[model samples]
Target: MECVGVRFAHSPKIYDYRFGSQAPPVGSWVVVKTPRGLELAKVRTEPRLGQAVGEIVRVATPADLDQHSKLKNRAEEVYWWLKARLRREGVRAKLLGCEFTLDGNHISVQYSAEQRIDLRRWVSELNRLAGARVEFVALGPRDQTAYLGTLGACGMESCCSNWLQDFTQVSIKMARDQQLPLSPEKISGPCGRLLCCLQYEHQQYQELLAELPRKNSKACSLQGVCGKVAKLNPLAGTVDLVTEEGSTVTVHKSELRWE
Candidate 1:
């Protein structure tokens, strides 16, 4: 099956959609039929063989673009109104943003909160007030950060907001294995969670660590001087040994024999 990648506004994840006979150029806008209804999405990749979640209705026309623009403005209005309403209702949720389907018949409002909220009563009220079906989406800390993107500590756009499609488990042990500082500010992302990049090179680091002697274990140099493995330089494939004479010497892993 021929499919192309499409992405909706305010989201980084790309979804595959069957284009059928219509070939939309990359970076062009197209209307796609989603479970929620019609949505305006940007073509992100050339057509390829893949399973599609839905089908593209058609390439967006100028009128469709105009309607999409108006829908964005309307969504913004709904966002502010909902924000104020939530405040008045004393809802303990942080509003991330709002999005409207291309047809303007549905609106999705995203929020983040420490606990789940019961908005069953507000759904009907919002539907009547906004003249569209209202959906409230709860986001985790990572999803909230992905929705409202910011520069990472590396001074580049965040991977979660750029191209990361799914969240993976990141552990403190990964940072420790890579010899990174365990400080929260250093190892944390804007999401207040462990940095996703920590796992990128973790396997390579682990492989390197496996080939080196464990820190604080005893090892002998090629010259027959035995010492405790004080520190490891996984990147350099070297280990620092603190000898019985209290002298520290750095040697390649191949030059040392594990004791």
Candidate 2:
């Protein structure tokens, strides 16, 4: 027996459509066994020989596609229902995404909230109301962006939904490199994700720091000694000096009356 593989449309699970000779036709919907349960899925990649182990029952007709389209198109309505339902239940959840399988047998609802919510009862209510499989998926701030998506501050498409694959941890160091204020609002995005551009030019600023002086090497004429290099404006060519006399003096970088 020859095996064929098909990738899922929106999931990580891959299905192998079995055939004696050829691959399954494209745009066909089929049922496959997922770890959780049987899922009605679409065949993104038609099965090819020597593929991974999975079952792809058969190709679906145009009828299945039409039904699936209806279900998929109802995503907004379903999302609204879920939001209202959750609010009523005092769950405080935001509906981030809704997806329906090609067979219209499954509905996946993704959401994000500040705290954990026991939504089993709500899920049951949804299933009873919609007459379809209801799945409530919890998501993080970043995952919400990946699912629902929104425009970024740059007035362009969001990175999470468009191109970015992984979210790297950002820190205050990155903000310091770019000489940005340490305020949280300026550095955060709508999704609370760090500004994507923070990582850029960081190394350049770090290298620029290397040519800078060590603190306490210079002195302020007004005050006896400066504590340390509290702040520096390279562009302004000004260094804030804290003197030993316990006073602060703004001195020009080029004005070295130090000697």
Candidate 3:
């Protein structure tokens, strides 16, 4: 049950593989047999006790690395060629990237389109031209954005393209619980989805909110003054109370008791 996590090129997701006879170090490259074909992947985590989906073929040799580099260049060429061909044929698709298996027996072409495209003819032509199997992969908005990386609203690289290995469920409720503005422009990432970071500190925010008085609830301050809870500052651990004297005052949560 010993397994290690491996990541493929141009993707952040990691796959667990069992190293049958090889002990590939972290950050090293290894050849693994995927469902599609034999692929070169980087070791992202050290070997640990876990379930593995696939088995590593072997540690990648220097020749394997060289071959991978050449295939990468060739994939770039094929991608451009396919892009131009698609444009000329008026095909409504955006080519994201192209990759070849380490053994050069298969080619994976990533693309995004509004609808399914019947590219049987193109696939055949590419197969004959490259002398390898060609397959098109349809990508969703999030995967498309991950393939073609861009800066995020935080002026840094998007998390999906950076170090995030898997996409998690992110909801507007997380933003609301964190007291963030509900504006889509402010909360959505380049993928036109809720920002992934919104879920990072959500649990902590929820815990803090549980200890604070709900808005519009009756509460008494430490000085024996009573007021209605107006607003909450979860981060600051303070609440804005509108006093019965018609004044808004900020008081720490510890200084207030809910009625």
Candidate lDDT (C-alpha), each = 0.91, 0.65, 0.89
Better TM-score candidate (2, 3): 3
lDDT of 2 at 124: 72
Q: Which TM-score value belongs to model 3?
A: 0.89
TM-scores, one per candidate: 0.94, 0.62, 0.89
lDDT of 2 at 217: 65
Q: List candidate 1 stretches off by more than 4 Å.
A: none
lDDT of 1: 0.91
| Clashing residue pairs found in predicted model 2 | 225-243, 225-244, 226-242
Winner by TM-score: 1
> Where does candidate 3 stray beyond 4 Å?
224-227, 243-246
Which window of 10 residues has the lowest lDDT sum in candidate 1? 118-127
Residue 75 in model 2: shift from native, Å? 3.5
Candidate 2: where are CA atoms >4 Å away? 1-65, 214-259
